[model samples]
Target: EIDKKSDIEFTLKVSYLEIYNEEILDLLCPSREKASQINIREDPKEGIKIVGLTEKTVVVALDTVSCLEQGNNCRTVASTAMNS
Candidate 1:
């Protein structure tokens, strides 16, 4: 039934973020220079919201997968005692 509901279209927005060391970074940022510290706040009408985040509208599964891969590549990695 769900699979046959392809005609039911809707907007799908996707965003990626990495939260580490008490900081939130936008993984979808084009460059480090353009990357700004993301913030979370409560809006009276809209409820909790992310202040500044990169969001991309994806039409297909491949598009979403691409976004995920891009963000994953840009993810911050640090050598820890266990990981190193």
Candidate 2:
């Protein structure tokens, strides 16, 4: 389980069954300057595109699965029983 805490007086939670369901990728910063400095690279082959940016917001194209895979033991599977 991933837990996040902030002192900025707001709450945020992001979850995905395939990507970051089991781990936290990176902490969301209060400022874009801080978030920009973070070396969270997705894929060079896919190409990184700067969608938007600001003092409070920064958006970029990234592969969620790549980021999540960096965390420990992120593999998961579902099972079904034939007998009841």
Candidate 3:
């Protein structure tokens, strides 16, 4: 279950099962996923931009950077299944 109020977010998980002919708490766990920040800066001397990201391993750009001093800098990226 997820409950949201104002700018706060909460998540709760509950699981119940019957054991020994009686109801009991099989599992009760809660988890949360928080957003991370990524910063991207252009390096004029290197002729390429550097991106700092978290939790995400892949980045996709639709447009091309013609002003880039280096060769084509646009390409497709895929994240590993373990990271995903």
- Which predicted model would earn the best TM-score? 1
- Give me the runs in candidate 1 sitting further than 4 Å from their true place: 1-9, 44-46
Q: For residue 47, what is the lDDT in candidate 1?
A: 100
Tens-place lDDT per residue, model 2, 1-84, is: 134654445433233222234432233233335434333345679775233221222133244443344322433344547432
Model 1 C-alpha lDDT per residue in residues 49-72, reported as the tens digit of each score = 887789999999999999999999
RMSD, candidate 2, Å: 15.8
TM-score of each: 0.77, 0.18, 0.18
Arranged by TM-score, best first: 1, 3, 2
Which sections of candidate 2 miss by over 4 Å?
1-14, 17-59, 68-75, 82-84
Task: Give the candidate order by descending lDDT.
Answer: 1, 2, 3
- Compared with the true structure, all predictions reach lDDT values of 0.87, 0.35, 0.27
* TM-score, candidate number 3: 0.18
| Residue 30 lDDT (model 1) | 88
Q: Pairing residues by index, what is the TM-score of model 1?
A: 0.77
Candidate 3: lDDT of 7? Answer: 70
Question: Which 10 consecutive positions of candidate 2 have the poorest summed lDDT?
Answer: 49-58
